[model samples]
Target: MLLLFLLVLFTQNYFSHGDLIADTCKKTEYPRICVSTLRSNPDSKTADVKGLVRIILKAALGKANTILNQANDLLKKTKDRLVRQSLNVCVSVYEEALDEIPEASVNVGTNNFEANIEASATIDIADDCEESFSNSPFTADNNAVKQLAVVAVDIIASLG
Candidate 1:
């Protein structure tokens, strides 16, 4: 009986994340990233679609802040005025993204279309930042936030 109970518990734990995160993430462009990230968060073990949006948006916000800091740090180190200018552009968009993410978080399930618009902006922010670098941008960081934001937007659309 104990072994059967354990097996049931294990299966419940496994399939909880499996079905919820899987169904949602399959709708995203980057399914692996979405599943891995959502599964990494303890809260996601039981999260509904709205809860998942909160988690992804939070991750996007953190990554945006990290990339903003990287751009600022590079800005200070560079001697070339052109590189500094590009860094400035990155810095600006990241700041704009920072503002949008919080708003997105607030609107998550209430009016998901609003959340979708805000989440959509993060993808553009990453693009603009990368374009400004013209060479080396926060490739990984930007990709992380962009993919997370895209996932959030797609999920938000699903809610509405």
Candidate 2:
């Protein structure tokens, strides 16, 4: 009897995790990316919606910080004044976006509306960064930053 009970409990938990991932991913614009990224994290196996958003937000922030660091490094390597200026702009914009992530995470617990707004603002910062390089030869970096921003936006929209 105890063995049967344990089997049932384990089955329910396993199915529940799958269901939660499906439900959560369905809410996002990029369902595939959402599912794959969240599933890669062990915590998502048991996290509720808010917890999942928090995780996504943290991941987005990490990406933004990475871009910022890359921009800074590029600035040091490039001697052209225009390229250095563009990289500096990217660094600053990413910094602002990174600042908003914690605020968004805080708001996620009690007010998803505010959290969404904050997240949307973060996306805008990324757009500004991309636009800053419109005439520059940094298309690859710009696209990479835009992709990260889109992921962050998709995660925010999922909170709805």
Candidate 3:
């Protein structure tokens, strides 16, 4: 069963009827301003496809780090143990999300699927973080969790 699911996912990602990879590459241009500032100069290290993927990875990582830092900072400011615990989970999720990229790169290669992989990683990280936050010590504080959720959503949106 697991193998079947894996096969389905791989096929859907790489050989779907639609060219989601190309579409995602096109969307990467939307964050050119953010990418330029966050990554190295826009010099032609490679073709636009690879260059754009690099930019997307850089920008997504930057956004993820920023969100994680904000959560940590907020936790530090608050003495509430629940908030601190939730923030710790958020931190862990961000770390795992960041950690997955290198492996994903190896799996998908740098030339293609980079943007798609980054987006998928961001979504996974956000979902995991949100789930962890909601069920932990901070279950009562929906408002703060909502704010963190907004940050995750913004990070995903910014990537596009």
Candidate 4:
């Protein structure tokens, strides 16, 4: 009985953290991003699902801030009226997404599905930003913004 107990304890301790993270990541739409992001963060190394959700939310918020900053900076540099207009739209879209991130983060803690819906809407913001630059000379910028938004969407999907 003593040996059996010791073996069980060792196995549980050995597998619990890593296994928990991997299992949770598997549920996310972007498993690679989910696993890589969680594994890279020291705080998430031993986190449960709730903890992982918070970590992911934090990361998404940071990414949204980055997108917002990038849009603002681009708006300042470009002299083209059309490009500036498109970038302005991007700034507004990212701002809304940034606001949604914190609200979603809070609601996610309580298992609120509405938070997931709000978070998912962030993708539409990115799409609109990209569409604003359609047939314009801002293809690279559009792609970059869209990529960041995709990451946010993936993070939100994981929350659901």
lDDT of 3 by residue, 7-42 (tens): 998887544422433443334433334333323534
Residue 18, model 2, lDDT: 84
lDDT computed for candidate 3: 0.50
* lDDT of model 4 at position 119: 62
The worst-scoring run of ten residues by lDDT in candidate 1 lies at 130-139
TM-score of 1: 0.90
Ranking by lDDT: 1, 2, 4, 3
lDDT of 4 at 123: 60
lDDT of 4 by residue, 16-65 (tens): 88887777767655667777877888988666666776677677667667
Query: By the TM-score metric, which is better: model 2 or model 4?
Result: 2
The residue ranges of model 2 lying beyond 4 angstroms of the native Cα positions read 135-160
For each candidate, what TM-score against the reference?
A: 0.90, 0.85, 0.48, 0.75
lDDT of 1 by residue, 56-128 (tens): 9999999999999999999889899988988999899999999999999999978788899999999999988
**Tens digits of per-residue lDDT for model 2, 99-147:** 8888988888677778877877777777777777757544555454455
Clashing pairs in 3: none
